[model samples]
Structures are given as structure tokens and as C-alpha cells.
Target: MTDWIASPLEWLQNYQLNLLFSAVVVVVYFIIRRIVLPKLEAYVERDNLNQQTFRSALFTFSLLSAVVALGILLLIWGINIRELLAVSTGIMALTGVALFATWSILSNVTAFFILLSHQSYRRGNYIRVIDVDNYIEGYISEINMFNTILITEDRETVVYPNNLLTARATIINPRDRKRPIGKIEDFRKTETSVDGGLNDKD
Candidate 1:
């Protein structure tokens, strides 16, 4: 045991190269997180998505990034990649069989990520989800990890799955756009059309 304590400098000298490479890996991971996460958070805010879902997403992505960093470290330390793949394969086989029935849940979670990146879509947007058979129109209330909460014009609530929403063609800004009018035109326009069109009143 005395020899172990006596060779601290020798041990560091032997592994200094690996340690330096590991430090580089760690710094790169942190740099990626610092640059990417804030932009994601900004998109979340701009889209008015659920903050709770954002926190969940952050945790999930961080876990993924940690796993990737660990894999790189294992490679740098001369660990056999095959063993890592074997263990990963075994885990996947178990989870895949167990989760076969609930695979849609995974799809919904992934679709939430896709939906989260769309900066133009917002919680307050009046959107129409159109499919071959029919369509549903509503204002987006909240976008959670699994489903989107929509409030219809009739005040009825629709809980739509994220995957389905991503599959469908969504019409945003379906409402009419109006041109800005000056004071003179504003005074000239005494009434609006009952149909919500900008027609002059007789």
C-alpha cells in the first residue's frame, strides 16, 4: 500500500494523455449543451409550449448527451466497443419486447420534440388539423409531452396525440388578415361585415 501512495506522480504520468483527451471530451459536451439548450428554451418560450414539458425534455436530452459522452470516454480508454454494444443490445431487446404494445407512447414523445422545434406554432394559435376524413379547429392551449390540449370555439376540449398532429396537415393563421388603416380610412369604415369580412356597410 505504501508503494501505491508513493507512485502518484508515476500513475498520472502514465495516464496523462488519456486524461487530457477525456477533459477535451467533457469540455466539448458542455459547450454543446450551453449553445444548444438556450436556443431550445427560447423556442419553447416563443412557442408558448408547456414549461413542464420543457424541463422533462431537458432532462431526457441531458441523459442522452451523458450516454454519448460516456461512450466516447469508454472508447478513448481502450474499452472494447463490442462489449458496450452487446450490453446495449441486450437492454434494447428486453425493453423492445416489453414496450412493443406501448410503442405509440414513444412515438408521441418523439413527435413532441418535433413539434417543439416548430417556432411558428404557438399555444394561442388558431389552427385547423385536416385529414382525409374531416378536420378539427381550435386554439392550442398547451403542448405537453404526449398530447396537445386544444380548446375549440365551442369551448369543448380536444386532447389530440402529438404523433397524429404531426402527421396531419395543419393550417395556421386560418383566420383572415387585415390591412392596417390610417385615421382617415378608420373614420370611413363605420361597420364591419357580419361574416367577419372587411366589407363596407351600406
Candidate 2:
């Protein structure tokens, strides 16, 4: 037990620079946590996207950035900077590959919330999404991440990827379309309606 502690302690003493580097890393990480991340999150929240997408991307980026920062911290603390650099490069390469590998899954997840937010179609709304170059008409039963649950007239449930949902042409009932209209308050009550009702329509 003494040998274990002694070895690490001796290493720290010999490489005091490593310990100093670690301290600097900790300070930088907290700075980013306090400053950068919050600003990015605010920007993401204000943008017009599915809340989930904004939240997810912000979270993922924060996690990735923190991890990278930690690695840099490790190099500063005691690990060889050369080795850390190599490891970081390798990690970046792997990240690029992973993002591409999971493109469809990510895209589907993003589009799912987008579909729901836009009210492009809602539960019980009839929709047609072409699959395999064939149009499948069905009613949306449930919409979730990755897959959308659709039920046909025959009561068969078809699960389709949201990526496909965004890509393919979709038809929604015109009656189901609802757009937002902001309220305007009249400063003074000037005119009454033809039927003796309040004329709020400007």
C-alpha cells in the first residue's frame, strides 16, 4: 500500500509541471462551464427548432467539449502531453466516424421532434409517406424519437424512420392545418360588429 502511494507521490514531485497544468485545466473548465455553455444554451433555446434538438445538440456538444477539456486537463496534470495529443487526435477521428455512422439515427431523432413541433401531422391525421417508392397512407398514432407509429385502415401499425418522414413527400389534411395568430388589443373601442358583437378583427 505504501509503495503504491509512494510511487504516485514521487511522480507528482518529479513532474510538478503536471500538477500545475492540472490546476490550470480545472480553472479553464469552470470558466467554460460558467460562461460559454450558458451562452450557447441561451442561443439554442431562442432559435426556432424543436426544443429537443436544441437541447440535445447543446448537451452533446457540451459533453464532448467537456470531455476534450478533461483530456487536456489530464495532460496538464501529469500525463505526457505528447501521448495526450495523440489520444485526442484519435478520439477526434473516432468522433467523426461515429457521427457519420449514426447519421440516420440522429437525423430521425431530430426530424421526429421537428415533425411534432410543426404540427405537420398530428394524432389521427391522415398522412401518406412513400416507402420503397410506394405511397403508404395511414393515420399517425404516435410520434416518438427515431420511429413514427402509423396505423392503417386495416389496423396494421407501420413504424417508419423520422428521417424518411422528413425526406419524402407528405400529405396532411388541409382542415388539420393550424397557424399561429398573435393577439392585438385595440387601444379604444371604436366600432361594433354587424351582429352587435365586439369588433376585435382588424
Candidate number achieving the greatest TM-score relative to the actual structure: 1
lDDT of 1: 0.76
Candidate 1 Cα outliers beyond 4 Å, as residue runs: 1-6, 87-103, 175-202
TM-score: model 1 vs. ground truth: 0.71
Model 2, residue 68: C-alpha shift (Å): 9.1
What TM-score fits each model? 0.71, 0.41
lDDT scores of the candidates, listed in order = 0.76, 0.63
Per-residue lDDT of 114 in model 1: 80
Cα lDDT of candidate 2 equals 0.63
- Kindly list the per-residue Cα lDDT of model 2 for residues 87-138, writing each as its tens digit: 8889878666644343546666556545655655666777766444356667
For 47-97, candidate 1 gives per-residue lDDT tens digits of: 877679779779877986898798789878978779978987896686565
